[model samples]
Every structure is written in C-alpha cells, then in structure tokens.
Target chain A: MHADPKGVLTGVHFLDGDHACCEGTLAAGARFSAGYPITPSTEVVERFAWRIPTVGGIFIQMEDELAASIAIQGAVWGGAKAFTVTSGPGFSLMMEHIGYAAMTETPCVFVNVQRGGPSTGLPTLPAQADMMQARWGSHGDYAIIALCPNSPQECFDLTIQGFNLSEEFRVPVMMMLDECVGHMTEKVVIPEADQIEVTPRRYTKLPPEEFHLFEPREDLVPDMVKAGDGYRFHVTGLTHDERGYPSMNVETQDVQVRRLQDKLKPLANGRALCETENLDDAEVVVVSYGITSRVAQRAIQLARAQGIRAGKFRLISAWPFPEQRISDLAGRVKAFVVPEINLGQMVHEVARAAAGRAAVIPVSHAGGSVHNPDAILKAIVEAAR
Target chain B: MNQVTLEIPYEIPVDAHNPVEPFLRMDRMPHIWCPGCGIGTTVNCFTRALLDSKANLDKVAVVSGIGCTGRVAGYANLDSFHTTHGRALPFATGLKLANPELQVVVYSGDGDLFAIGGNHFIHAARRNMDLKVICVNNLTYAMTGGQTAPTTPDHVISATSPYGVFEPSFNLVALAEAAGASYVARWTTYHVKQLSRSMEEVLSKKGFCFIEVLSPCPTLYQRRNKMGDGLDAMKFYKQVSKIRHGAPTSECALTKSGEIVVGKFVDRDRPDYLELLRGQMTESLGDRYAEPEVSCSC
Candidate 1:
C-alpha cells in the first residue's frame, strides 16, 4: 500500500464523466493504460495518459483499440493492473480479444463508455443499448463480469472493484459506462492511497516446475504466473485441460466451458454480487442498469412521493443477470418496468426472471437520448394501478 | 562479456538437413496440413527466420488467430498463443505491449487477417506498434472448406464464390503501406530464401512490420483453380514471380499468373506511438514525481 500524501477521501472536486472515469481508474491501482481517442471516451484516455505517468505508471495512446486492448493485456501479464477505455465502435473492435482474455483467464479491465451504435450512430451522445451486447457480443459460450456505474463516484469505486474482481476470478472484468456517466461531471472525493485496497495478481508460491497456467485450484480460480517468471506454461484459446494444452475431446471441452461459466455464475446468485434498492413491500419495480438506473431511481422517488408504491433495482453487476433477485422480487411486485436506451433488451431478462409472476413492460428509446424519468414514472403508475 | 570461440572443420549441408529442425517440434511431425499445402513451406521459412534473427527464445511469444496458418504457433517451440479468429493481431499487440521485452509475432490466414480482422490490421499498421504480423494469403478460406476470402481475386472461384468472386482482391503490400506500416514486404514459397529474408527483416524492424506470404492451398485453392499439387504451385511461382531488388511502389500489385512481387516496401521510423506518448508524459510532469491528481470528478 502506498502512503496517502493527500488525506483519505478529503478532496472534493467536480469533473466531467470522462475525467471521473480516468481518476477512478488511477485510484483503483491501474498502473498501465492503453487507449485510442474515440469521441466521448477519448477524454478518459487523455486524462489517463496524463494521470497514470505521475503515479509511476505507464499510459500509452495506442494506434487503435486493438493495439490499446493488446497493450493492456500485456501489461497485466507483466504483473501490472491495467485497463483500456473505449466507446461503441472501439468496443466492437475489442470483442474478439475480450473473448481471448476470458478464454485464457487473464486478469484485466476494460471500460466501454458507450455511444449509440450498431455502427457510429451517435458519437457525442449517450446510450444504454450496449447492455445486451456487452454480455453476448463475442462469439462463444463464456461468462464475463460487467459492472455499470450510475454516477462518477460509482465509476471511481467500481473501476477499483472491476480490477479486484478481475484479479480474484482471474478473468477480464468490464466497467460498462455510457456517454452519460462517462461525460457527466459530479463532485467526487479521491480516497487516500493507503485507504484504497489494491489487489495485486496472485502468483504461485510453488516451485516453477509444478506450475500450471490453467490448473484451477480448489476455489476454481487458478494462480497465474507471468511469462518471464521461469514457469513455462502453454496457454491457448482452444478448449483445453488443466495443463492448458489444446483438447477437443467433448468431456474436456465441457469441463473447460463449465469452469468459465461457473466462476462468475455463483456471484450472480449470491447477495454480495449485486445491488437492489427499495424493493421491500413494493408493488412496482423498475429494473435497470448503467446510466438508465439513475433515471429509474429518480422516477421511483417521484412515484413514491406521488402516493404510488414503487422501487428500483439497480444492477451493479449485469452479466450473470440478477436472475435470483428478479425472480424473488417478482412474487412481491405487481409488475417489473424495464427502462433502457435500447428496445426490449434487458426487459427480456426481466421477463424470464418474472416467469409470469408479474407483467414485465419494456420502455425503450433508441440511440443518443436516455429513457426519461417521466416515461419511467408513468410506467410505475400504470404498473401500480 | 566473456568471449568463447570454437572452430568446426566439418562441411555443413547446403540446405542444412532441415533449417527448420532447430525451432520445430519434430515429434509433432507430419503436420496437419494437406498434401499439396504450401503452409508447411511458409512455416519452414518462419522458423528459419527466427533462428537467423536470434531473438530471445524465452521472450518470444507467437500469437496465432484461427485458420491453417494460425496453427504455426502450436508447431513452434516457443511461448505460443492460439487466440480467437481474426484476433491474433490484437492478442499479439497485448502480448508485445505488456512485456515490451518480448518479441511478439502474429501469424494468421487471409480470412483471419483481411476479412474479419481487416480493421485491426490497418489500425495496427497505422499505429506502428512494435510487433510483426505475417498474413498467409492463400487467396481463399481453406480452413472453412474453401470459402471466399477478402484476398480472393476477382473471378476466382471458391465455395461461396461459385460464380466467380465479384469483389476485387486487396493488395496486402499496398494496404500496409497506405496504413503506415513501418516495414512491409511480400513473397511466396517459391522464393523460399527471399521469403525467409523478408521475415528476418520484419522481425528486426522496430515498429509494426507486415509481411504477406502468398502460399498455395492445393486442397481448396489449387484444386479449384486447377493449379496442380503443391510442387506444381511452387513451379508456377518460380516461373511467374518477377523479383526486383528495389521495385517501384506502383509495380507491387499482383500480376496475372499469380506472380509475387518480392521486396521490402516501406522502412522509415516515425517515433513509435508508445515512445511518443512516454516523451509527452515525461515533459508534462517535469520533476513533480509525487502521485498525479486523481479525482473521480473532472
């Protein structure tokens, strides 16, 4: 732990969403950053490049997102906590490597401050549309851990958590931000360096001869060793056994895929893995994540003041969808209202978890604009009535 | 440094019993490539280049994307990464940047590099990242049962291009040069020695280096185009290739009869992206070595 020259959590300052994300990444013990300049997300990289080096870290403005992503992965392998920030178009380019990290179980972080897009729909605007894509964009059956930060502070705190989760699970963790949260400036306090808990990657204490790169421990997360650490372990994206050698055998494939899925699925069901707000005894619940969650929260508060029973379920971890929480809440709530920037994406998940217990209504808007609180409040009232 | 010298008077074989023997896994012999495949020869050239460059063996990381050429990483006795399809460059990029000391090489097929990963290829070249990319342009997707790839020439037939490919082929050397690759070259298996030399040059280049090897795919491409077996493809290459030491940039285009224009295309330094970034960072801080301002709010 480094000493805090600045008192812990004493600095209160206002910044845009991008600067907040940049600061959050630095505070989270990110010693290396590599990124390209893409609109809305560019500031995150610019700020990171300026801030990372001052903390005795390396910040690189890479040739593109591909290079940026690759550099961050390399830094992580070199035993440094690393990350890259990009928007929708760049995010699309990073999908393949993101899957590679997941398959290889390399610990790293990626922040996608999303813009509206199937392809460059809106560069300067916000969109929660990437929610579904973040979970299923890359080709394959693998689980990913993605967190949505509602405010700049959450962005700062969750960026650290993203690094921690990545190191703990030995997998790539995504900090899913939007143009809104990425660019939205708010007063945020930087924690003292000593106060912030930074988790370094776990290394094998065993002799180099006994080390296996992909050999899962009893906890299912393997202890990773870096390339030049004298431990020669083969790693591939192919389905492989504990030795990390390529194996196409059905049984081996099943086990490998199951391990990737299992590592993150347990957290989705457990209490500590997700966040829910004001759901007790509520008749109407709005299910949302990312920037839209903030809008839903405001609507929930407004609905409550207007004599309607409403609550909000803000998902911090979005990938292993809070299925159990939604399922449990379905029995008590009259209806689940899903407000997302994209049309009916998360609503499908809510509907699946609802399983006919409550009506799952989707209030969606496509590209640039966020789902307004009025639209959500109306849904809460309609669900309540 | 301690200097030790030994002298051996024995005459070594001209072809060296197998120049690839030093780096290859002979136990994994009789590779998975088809009888007429030129991939074996391409792999042979690559291994020879590695031996010639004397790159730090332990720090060498070979990252391969999906395709027949992608399997080269597995065959090499080094730190290998068989990554996802069309992602070898990005994976290699990560590997190189993470451990700047490591020599990173990306090997992928035409379908992997030019089609799905085309965007990454151009961007990587433009950034001039300190990594080497070797694209095996067999002109078709041989791995997926001979599908049409981006490099498949117009009027060439494949599984998906039964009526002849309508799309014009991408000239890889031109593409690399346009995208700002610090080093770009092209060669075929027929020019084995020249191809090997080009590989060495790319390996030695400080920034993004791209080499496209026009290999033959006898099972899919050769059989469909009636180009005969692997040996026949080599013979065709020998007769058609027009090798010039300093060929003009305009003359690097593909000619009829599949002639490969072999030579270095681009070799100039433009302070690599990472180096420029570091210089700027150092200049900005200027003696204030303490922790930089870190605030979540902008």
Candidate 2:
C-alpha cells in the first residue's frame, strides 16, 4: 500500500535521527503517540508533539512510562498505528506493557534510543546495551522485532519498516537507536508519499458471529478489528483461547504461547534485514550493528588494505538475530569478530549460532561512548591469524 | 439429624430469559465472582444503564485493570480490554483519544484504581478526558485473598491488618472531586436503581465522570471482618446511608461505623482534553491544524 500523502513530507532536509524517526512515523501513517520524556530519547517525541498537531494526530504526554507504553496499545486497538519512545530507565518501566502487547498480539512500535544504563548511567551518551533487553526484557518467552539503524537516513527508512513488520507479524517492533545515532545530524532525503510502502492493519472481514479474535490464519496471525466496529471482541493479557476468552489451562498455554513465537519464524531468513559484504571469500567477519557498524566499516577497509581477508556483516534487524545466515557462514569462516557498544550482548548470539563450527571473538566495550575503530581492527587482525 | 429442606424464596422462570444476558458473554458464564459478591450486581446495573440510555453497544468499550472487579471487561459484551494491573485509565485515555466516536469506560477495583493506579486516576481526572470510570470499591483486594486496601476503613480487620488497620483510608468521592472530575458521585450496590441511573447519566456526560460503587466482597472482606454476609452489609448500607445531593465531599469520609454519605458532589462544565487540544492547536496553527479523523480508512 502507498503511504498517506497527507502525512509525508516530500522534501530533502538535514535532520537528526530523532526528527527523522518522527517523520518516518508520520509517513508510515501513525496518527497517535503516547510518550513520557526521557533523556536522549525525548527529542523524538518532542519533534512528534510539534509535528503531529498539524499532521492531524494526537501526541499525549502521559503521566509516566507505564502509561505511555500501554496508552499506545490502546490507540492501536482503537484503529490507529501508534508508538512510544523512551530510554533506559523508561524502557525498563515499559517492559511489562511490552509483554502485554506481545501477549495480546497488539501491533505497535517501541522506539528505544539507547543510552547508558543499569540504572541512570549516562543520559547524554550512547550505548548499545539494550540489544538483549529489547529481546528478553519483557519477562516472557515471546518474540519481537528489533531494528538497528546506523544513520539518520536509515533511521527514517528502517522506522517505517519497523511499523510495517509490526503490522505484518502482529508483534511489537523496536526501533533501536543509540544516543550517537539519535543525536547526530545528517542529510536525509525523504521520498514522496507514493514511493513509500506501508502495510495497512489486517482487519477481519468475517461477520461478528463467526469472527474469533485470536483465531490465527495460515500464517498464525489473527486479523484484527477496532473497538467501535461492532465485532464486540474481547482482548486480554492472560493465556486465552482462539475466542479471546481467558482459558488458564496448560493445553491453552501451550497452544497460545507457541504460536506467538512460531508466527515470526518466517522473519529469520526471508525477511531478515542485513547488509553483508565479502563473506564468500573472507575468512573473518566483523559482526556489528547500529553506530558500531559504521565504525566497523573503517576497520574492514583497513583490514582489506593489508593481506587479511576480513568481511562486514551489518545487522539492520538485530532481533531474530539472522541465526540461519550466521550458521551458514560459520562453516566457511575462520572466525567471527563481533564489535558492539556493549559488553558482548549480541556477540553471544553470534557464538551460539556458530555452535563451535568456528572461533568467535567479542570486542566488548563498557559503553559510555562508541567503540574505537582500531579496537575492532585489532580483533579482526587477531582473528585473521 | 435428617436434612430438612429450606424453602426457596424466588425462582427463575424456565421459559424466561434474563434482560441483561444479551449484554454479557453468556458463553463465558457462569461468572467467576464469589457467591453474594457485589461486582455482578454492579454489572447488572451497568447493563441496565446501557439499555435505558439507549447507548450504541457497538460504540462502547470497557477497559479494566487487574482485580476481581477487573474481570468486568471479560464478561462485558462490548469491545473490551482486560489490560495490565493498574493502567486502565491511560489505556482508556488512548482509546478515547484515538477514536473520539467511541464511548470509553474504565471499570476496575479499589486497590487497582486507588493504590497502584492512583497517579493515572488523578491525572486522567485532572485532564478531564472523556471516560466513564466505575470503581467497585470492595475495600479490600478480594482477588488476592483479602489484603488491606487503600479504602479499608481505620480499625477494620483484614488479612494484612489482623491487628486492625492503623493507617487512614481514602475518601474516594473527595479524591475524585479534588482531581477535577466533570461529574463525581458515590453509591452502594444496595442502591441499584440509583446506581443504574447514575451510570445512565454519565453516558451522556462530556468529560471524565467517576462513580464509586461501594460493593460487598463477602468471601474475603466481609468474612475477614465480623460483617455477616452480603445481605447483612446491604442492610447496614440501607440503615446508615443518607443522600445529600450536593453535600461537601470533604465531610463524606467513611468511618468503620458512621453515616454513609452518598450523592453527586461535582458536576460542572469544562473543556475536555480533546476540546482543549483542538482549540489550542487550531488557535496556534490556524487552518494548518487538521482535526484528526475519527476512523481509519483501513
């Protein structure tokens, strides 16, 4: 489907990642947002608050992150594409609702502009520490889509993809941005409305009597209906049957929870977004995402300048981990040098996917700042040996 | 001793159907409420109000937080959401703002709405969002086995307060009024007709309207205390309750044994969140401000 022209800003402009993400939400046809202000991530909603009013939408500043997170789900069920933004502490507060969104299969977006944390570590600096939290912080065995954008342009581009994937899989999508990417200014060219593709919500056409709210189709995703549409559907956060009624038995739990993960199996390969280069001939691959991918690019170039054969595997969608592709490369590659702004978060996934088939080296950082390219270069050089 | 049959006072006719059955998920019944519980009674009043007010059942959505009363959303035959514990108000806020055409209602319990959800309640009321809030105040957390609640009166014995509660209790009607609700009222489940009428009244009200229904949690609350059963509590309400239509809310705080003040306290006009949003946006941005569309084309 084509993007709504009313929300698209068809022009070239120099913008930061936060502003670009806000524009992406507009072009993706999001008409409602609920947010609580937090450092580094606050600009995204600040821009949204100013931009959404003229674009014909509501940007509610909720009481706190708990309200902000669940409020967007309410908007989604009320028949609007919606999202919320937060940083580390706020993201921690939103974890329960993220689980709620997963349990109910409410399609929405949660943009986490990563800042340093265990608590309030660094408000103004960047970190990639939230990669694992985005996957497992919701306290359940549920699957979610998380996208890592490396630049302002990709921030605009991937955010739209985030919303689309969320609707397609009926799961919450996370647009993972670090403080560097969120704050750095860059040139972004926003295409015309028709050039952008958006996925409309899959509303059920079955009559009210026959429609069951949680009945999955062939793809294991149920078609959704809005509140006022007379379907009289019931949605809850409990383990429910296909009729959307609470059924608290082990059999129902097995059926319900399994489908939540099984539905996204298609994303592991066919829809996994990554930028790969030189992997066929290269023996050592530097795995990275977000801002680290840009830094790793220079290291890959420096390794190519020498005699060592080092490749680049930049992840665009970080979650679902692209394990199949990594496993395929693990057989041929000598070693995987994983560089990230955190203390070896995604690197563990790389090691697990490699499964002793090849050596895996983690170039970890404590993450008050981005990784130094030479540190990644040193890992690549050692792995090549 | 041989068992002697106690005479049954009333019987449901074999050919008759309940009037409120159409407004409920009959397949999900019989409900989970304990015997002599007042949550079901409040649901009956709500369904009656829906019928009497001629509300478009299709356009009404019920949102509830986690508690025994929170299960109201599950049995309600409308677009309903059984959301997370203590977050129903914000969820209902989003529902109402996203589709202004829908009538959003938040129905939950005392501990869910007043303790953990206290911030959301006060903020939602302060904004005057167009939501009908019905808090079934059972004075205890009945779902979790009779814990002391924010509304548990002083000196009341609860599972958590076996020594009798030493903390002060909240006056819910006073809280609602102070938080700037468009309409605020209090009633007990014993006042079924008046409760139904108040529910009907709020359906047409423009902004945030709160009705605190003092309900009997017979299994946990009444059993923990020396209060007999739901019937005895109903009789107690009938004996002590006095209706003062515009009484000062500050003086309506309930004691362990005191006159139960019940009436409408706050009813006045103020622009709701959407109205204020649109007005400010239109004033600042002029024609550039497009009023949000009520329904998505998709």
Candidate 3:
C-alpha cells in the first residue's frame, strides 16, 4: 500500500472491483450501509460492514434486499449519505422500494453489481442484462439516474458521481456495475478526504411548520428534512401533491410525474451525460456502456489503427438514453454498432437514436464470456465498408 | 382486577385541527378501508404508541409492506416507507440498524408478514433486532379482495379458498415468542384499549418486540364468515376469548372453535442485534477505529 509521492491520486492501489466500489462508496461520504449479502455483490456489503464502523458510521446485514434498501433510506432520512449494494436477484427484490424512493423523492444510492438474470441466472458471473430493468424495473412513470462504470477506477469514481447525482436531483441513483468491474482487481486511487467533494441532501431551511416534503424548488428538486427533526411531512408511493399527500387527480399526477422525469432529462445533455471518442471523421460509431464499453473502446482503437474510421460513444448515464448525442453521431457516421453482453437491450435505444440516418446493427452476446473487442471491430469494419 | 382504562398517550393530536390534517390530503380523506375495518383502529393505536413513547418525531421511520394494514405508513406524518409486498420486516430491520437512534417500526398485515415474508419475520425476531413490529392479522388477504392467508382459519372461505381453507392458522404470539422476540403479546380489536396499551409497552421495549392485533376485516373476513358486521366480529371475540394469565406462550393459538387467548405472553431480556454488533465492532477496531484504513492491497 505504498503512497505515490506526486500526490495526483497518490493512494491508488490494486484491489478487486467490488472492494474498489466499496472504497468508492466510503469516499463518497456513505456513513450508513444496509444490505443482505448476495453473490457477486456480497463482497461489497462485507467490505462496507467492516469499514463503516471505523468511520463512526453503521453497517447492517439486513434479512434481505427489501430490508437493506429500506434501512438505507432510513439512514438517508436520518441525515446521512446512505447506500446499498446488491446484484440481479437483490435488485429484483428492491424494485418496489426503488419506485417508492422515486415517488418519495428520497436521495439514496443503490449499487447493483449486475449479474445475469430474470431470476438468479448467473450469480457469480458478469452480465449487463439489467440495463432496462434498472431504468424501468420499478412500477411507475418516474425518472431514474443509472451510471455504468467500465473499470475499477470508474467504479470508485462513478459511485461518488452516483451519490452526487442522487443528492443533487433528490432521486435514488443506481450505480449499474457488473461482475467484470465488481470482481476484477485494478489500481484505484482513494483521494484524500479533503480532495473529495461530498454533497449532502438539501434540508429545508424554512421553519418546520412551513416545510413541504414534495414541493419542488426552482431546480425541481424538493428540500428534504431528516426524520426526528420535528418537521411533519407525509411520504407515500402514490402520486402525490406538494405536501406529499396522495392526490388521485390526473392533473396532479401528470405534474408530479413530469417533474420527476424532467429533473433527470437535463443531466443527459450535460457534462456527465456521455463520453465520445474519435467520432469526428469516423464512418462507423460503436455505442456501448459498462464493461462492454471497454471492449468497444479497444475495438474502435484497433479499427482506427487499421485505417478504418471507427468511433466510440461510451454511455456514462445510460437511462435518459443519450438520444441527442447518438442522433448527432448518426448523421456524421454511416453506421452505428452496439455491442453488449445482453442479447439486444441497449441496441433498441441506439436504433431509436440512430433513426434513419445510419444503419444500426447489434453485436450481442449473452454467454459466460464478455463481448469481444475483435467482434465489435469486425462489426465496425463491415459497417465502414 | 382493577378496570384501569390505560391512558395511551398519542403523538398525533386527536383534536379538531386533526393531527394528520397537515399530512393528509383532505380530498383523499375517504380512504379505501371499509367502515369498521380494524386497520383504522390499528393505525390509531400505532400513532398513539409512537406519541406515548416520545420517540424522536424526526427519527421515527415507519415502514410497511403491501396490505390493507400497510397503508398505515401512508397516513403517517413521519418518515414513512410503503414498500413491496411481504418485505417490510427486512426493510424495518435495515432502517433500525442504519440509524440505531431512529425508532423503526414495521406495520404489516398477517399475509405480508407470515406468508410472503415468513422467513424474514422469524429471522428478524430471532436476531432480536431493535424494532417494533406490529402485525395486524385480519385472517385473510383483504387488500387483494379477500384471499386466504396463512393466518386464515382452517375452515375459512375466500377468493382462493371458495371452499373453506383446510390449513390450520399460525399461532403468531407463540411463533414470535419461539422465534426470540423480547416482547410478544396478542390482543383483538375488541380489546382496542388493551391493544393500544400493549403497543405502548412493546414500543418502549429495547429489543425486537411484536404485537399481533386481531384486526377485523369486515368486508373480507367478516363478510365471508357470514358475520353480520364489525359488531358481530367483536361479539365473536367477546364470547370466545378467555384471558388466562400465565398461560404458556407456546400454547396460544387462534382456532375457529377454540377460545381466543389474548394477553402479554412473553417479556424477557435479550441483547439486541445492534448493540451486539457495536460491541463486536468496538472490540475489533479498538484504537484504530476513528479513521478509515485505506487498503491498497488486492
């Protein structure tokens, strides 16, 4: 554990992706973590359970994912930056509450280290199959923020980003990590405490009597006050009014749903939205995210070195589907390639974004192995020709 | 025995202003509950219990699973979570452990707790987690339009059991006591005052405490059983219940023909899971506990 003298992320060290993610959670100011241990994601809870107490925080092994998610929400409401880590099965268990978090507009982070599944498909293996589920698994027309990290460093960095997004938007942010990044060991720098920027939830500055839990601010995010603060507020899963009470009126539901959707839409147009590489003079754009993005990047580089005009757009925030960027790239490129571990989830989104400007082709795999860089490169070359 | 009407102090005001008025959307006031549903009674008892305990209002986290009783959290003026079906206990367990200072309560129905979440229910009790679990048993799944539940009597008819249910019902008090709940008690809606008092006592208890209230589901259980109304259900309780003090917790069971045994069945000391965890953490970390140890080693 030698520290680098240069001080540019000096404490960087090699650790499995899961441990790195755990460290990233702590770096992001997560003081309370509650989760039931599940395969491929258990290491994260184990790491946090051991690490949190040292920071004068709490970590609890809940009875299940339902408990874990609720506990994390409780911690967040208790004025702590809280998170829960789980995988496919656990994510399925957590979907109902995920909608609850959205409806309540609670600021919390859920790290779903993806594995294959509809139900416990591949417990210890990597799979990016939960992309759609992460965005729309919960029952409702609410907006969600989902980030996919391709490497251990990204796992550490994006978790911080996830917490930030959750706090900033006052929404539950999901760090959609997979087994590849979650288990692979890599060099990750743990920034100094002073170097990290941690954003706590916005508390109501108004008097307790005047505070409204669901009233949107100028930014569309509601002010949250912790429980036990003597502020009385209602929270429910049903479509609600400004005061957090359920209102079945269609107009109220429409207004409330739109705000939840719009609050996250602007994020897709901004800095942390998407990352593009070599798209200027490229004839083919290979779009991908998560571990598949790493392969896509390699594929594009290989194609570019071979004199084929190939570009890459790694989706950082996958949910509000980077339609504008993909549309822009489609006009510039002759074709678009989407390579993913799943059969054809993100490809549909890419196809929608590409529309008629570029021919979109899916390079998909749902096996034990990841989508290869060679296959993606071949797809790019074929499209270029 | 002194006929003492225990004063169950309530946190939410019962006055003209309506304590829940600020949180309640008055237009949505006519909730979905049938008239004389025990859910309202249970909700009243819960709010009163929270108030009597003087629990930190801001730190009170109420979580409920899907059921008629699960709506208790929706009506509360607190940090409430209306979670997925049968998973409220786990969520409450998490909430309690996350903020040990916060008062975490699990308000759920019999089906939510004993059927779908049965595994979590027993395990949470066995761990003796610091939580207040209020199980409102209406004998059937009233929310899904009258389905047979785990707590449904052996000869009860419902949507799933158009013919009378053949399975014997769970003895929740005995189940909780055996599972290691530090506090275990049972009371029917007929004993609302006693139920409220029992809830107050359980709320004040330090370890995992469970109170099973025999709430009446007039629209479902009552209607199906050919019981006329909520009053008829109360009459059945009055005629059948035999309060035997010092009765063994394991012996308490609810049967269609058997006497309803209602009372505080178990109360004893057990180290709560959180305190035990803290002790283990303090012992392991020792002086090196204040700051996080960065591990650069893979």
| Candidate No. with top lDDT | 2
DockQ of 3: 0.32
On residues A1-385, what C-alpha lDDT tens digit does candidate 2 reach at each position? 9998888998998999999999999889998999999999999899989988778889999999999999999999999999999998999999999999999999999999999988999998999999999999988799999999999999899999999999998999999999999998999999999899999999998999999999999999999899999999999999999999999999999999999999999998877899999987899999999999999999999999987899999999888789999999999999999999888899999999999999999999988888888999999999999
lDDT of 3 by residue, A1-385 (tens): 2222221233869878788887777777677788888889889879887667666567767777877887677666556677888998899989977887888788888999898876879897889989999889988798888998888888888888888888889889889988988888888877776677766567778997788888888988888876656775556677778977767899998999999998887786654477887778879888889888888888888998999988878899997788888887778789999998889999998898788889998998884568878999889888988
Report how far off residue A262 is in candidate 1 (Å).
Answer: 1.0
lDDT of 1 by residue, A263-355 (tens): 886677773355566778788988888888888889999999998888778888887788988899888889999888887787998899899
Candidate order by TM-score, decreasing, is 2, 3, 1
Q: In candidate 2, what are the lDDT values of residues B172-283, reduced to their tens digit?
A: 9999999999999999999999999999999999999999999888899888787989988898889999999889999999987789999888888989999999889989
TM-score of chain A of 1: 0.95
DockQ of each: 0.25, 0.74, 0.32
Model 3 CAPRI rating: acceptable
- Model 3 alpha-carbon drift over 4 Å, by segment: A1-10, B1-32, B43-61, B290-298
Per-residue accuracy of model 1 over B1-298 as CA lDDT, tens digit each: 2223377688655565556766765645667899878888888888888889987777777778888998887777677777777767766665665567778888889899888788878877877778888888888899889998878887777899898888777888888888888888788888789889988887777898888888888899878877788889788888887776556556677733655678776777877756765666667766654432221110
Q: What is the alpha-carbon RMSD of candidate 3 to the true structure?
A: 5.7
Top-TM-score structure, candidate number: 2
lDDT score at residue A175, model 1, on the 0-100 scale: 86
Worst 10 residues of 3 chain A by lDDT: A1-10
- Model 2 TM-score, 2 decimals: 0.98
Give the lowest summed-lDDT range of ten residues in model 2 chain A: A48-57
lDDT of each: 0.78, 0.93, 0.80
